[model samples]
Target: MEHSTPYKIFLLWLLLSSLMLSGVFIVWDIGILRAILQQDITRISTIILFVFFGACVHCAWRSFYLARQALMLAYLQDELVKEGSAVQLLSLFPRGSCLAQEYLVGLYQGRDAQDKVLLSEIMAESLRGTHQVGWFIAGIVIKLGLLGTVVGFVLMLSSVSGLDKLDITDIKQLMQQMTQGMGVAMNTTLVGLISSMALGVQYLLLDRCADRLVVDGVNLGQAFMSVSFDERSGTL
Candidate 1:
């Protein structure tokens, strides 16, 4: 397999993130971003959106890191197949460098095929655990946006509490307050939905990349590495 196959998802992430950045610049250039900031008096919604963006970046980096590990695994698999020796495979890997080296070592140390299968699952989980926070933050982003909408409606309603009579001046003040509240509601909802969806796409890609890495590594191990199976075991 080409070494570059594992990194394709990461490259796509970079391209998509670049497009998002471009969109941000365009929004800023048009002054809409500035207007949203001014309208959101508490700035809470804006902060949430920024936090979501940071999470996306962090997850993307993690995915890229895993991709590199996959590439390393592929290289080691090629070497192991060529040399046909467990000792040679160990020599090819630097100390504590390869992601699945332990599993390979385990198989060579007399671990059975069943044990290898279990270890593969554990390794897959370990890699997947890194992205848990990113997924969680994605869900929180949407809820926070809805919270902002509620807060905005509260602000809009609060404008009429103390006034028993409506004078021209009081009515104008009320309208101004309502307008600000409405802006906050609309801005936050828009930001929240967009951020959540964008984050979702990135994470979905990362998930698929991780899965591919696990599958490729497992397949290589089954093909070239030594594994023992129980001859007495019966099929279901």
Candidate 2:
């Protein structure tokens, strides 16, 4: 596959985007940020959620790299078509493009039923790789949220475990304990749900791009197939 941009460029983009997102969070919801930071007793799970969110963003950007490559290659297909050489396509497919590779394989090897199966498998594998980490990220944040809920409950229960006489002091202490538990429970749940939802949307957009890339690749490969091998064998 032709590399339109280096991996380093993608890394730079991810870093900038992360910074931009963080800035937006500060402006839009600094309350949550403050809540997490101001705690004398830090919520470790909330901190971990932030780290997971960063990973999701990085993965989403990587998938976007494929989309951009697909768009560029599709646009250049026509100009390359007139050249009538598969060899010229080597640079266009970039090393990361599994979809383009399938089509290229069909161009040399027959595009029969077995080849179709092979291509389908290739596409599935590529899609799986694209999707796997995204949902895992979502799941992790959700599980963390649940874990926080359990922790909150345990803390609340423990705080009230010594309750004996029905007195104002004991009642006030119990309420304070319960309030702390509720804060932990609510805050973690809010963060988890928000993070998972945002990540899901990001992956959804990226996957759409990937689907288009596959379509474009298939179309280009079919076009490539139409050119006689005699016509296709030439130097760029």
Candidate 3:
């Protein structure tokens, strides 16, 4: 836990910081900070929602490197599975494949049904961080968007409820407040849904990449599997 804690924290900070940076970039694109801040075109929650979208983008971007490595590893493993001995592939496991290395070594030893199941679990666990990080972050972005939606709804409701109390002079202020509330409501929901879709697509690709790696690995391990015909043991 202690060793892994830092990595998790880094990812957390990276997501948040990326969101903030992306927000800044978007704002800058519209105009400089001075102009964007003074403009009434965008709402605060809308900006935050876009920032969250940026965070989702960052997750997809980060997954690219891991997916590429996994794809390459799959290719190499498939080649080895076709013609080579398990012993010959030890040197070929990519970096950050400690758990996979252990699984391969175990494979070289033997792989009955029970062993295969155990190795499958190990493989999933090993690949989770690399292949699923984007998906996890995407989930977070979707939730954040929902949170924004709730907040927006609350603000809009509050403004609506107070409308009866406004006098003639306050009508203008009330209208402004209502508009802001509506902006928050509409923007948050739109950003959240859009971000989730993009993130889902991004992770879908990464998952296929992981699937290839797992398949190639399974094939590699099964290539060297031993079968027994002993009556006591049955066929294994």
lDDT of each: 0.75, 0.62, 0.57
Best by TM-score: 1
Which model, 1 or 2, shows the larger TM-score?
A: 1
Ranking by TM-score: 1, 2, 3
What is the Å distance of residue 69 in model 1 from its true position? 0.7
The clash numbers for all candidates, in the given order, read 0, 6, 0
- For the record, the alpha-carbon RMSD of candidate 3 to the native fold, in angstroms, is 8.9
Candidates sorted by lDDT, descending order?
1, 2, 3
**Error at 78, model 1, angstroms:** 1.9
For candidate 1, the lDDT comes to 0.75
The 10-residue segment of model 3 with minimum total lDDT is 1-10
Error of 3 at 4 (Å): 34
Whichever of 2 and 3 has more TM-score, that candidate is 2
For all predicted structures, in order, the TM-scores are 0.87, 0.74, 0.63
Per-residue lDDT of model 1, residues 26-125, tens digit only: 9889998788877899786678778877987797787688777777887877776676555556556676677567656666664556787787887788
Cα lDDT of model 2 by residue, 1-236, tens digit: 44455443345446655764886488458575676444414374556567566866666566666655555555457555577666566555555554565556655566476785577457646754657677787778877777767777777787777777557767887888877876777666666666677666656655665566666666666666655355555422
RMSD of 1: 4.4
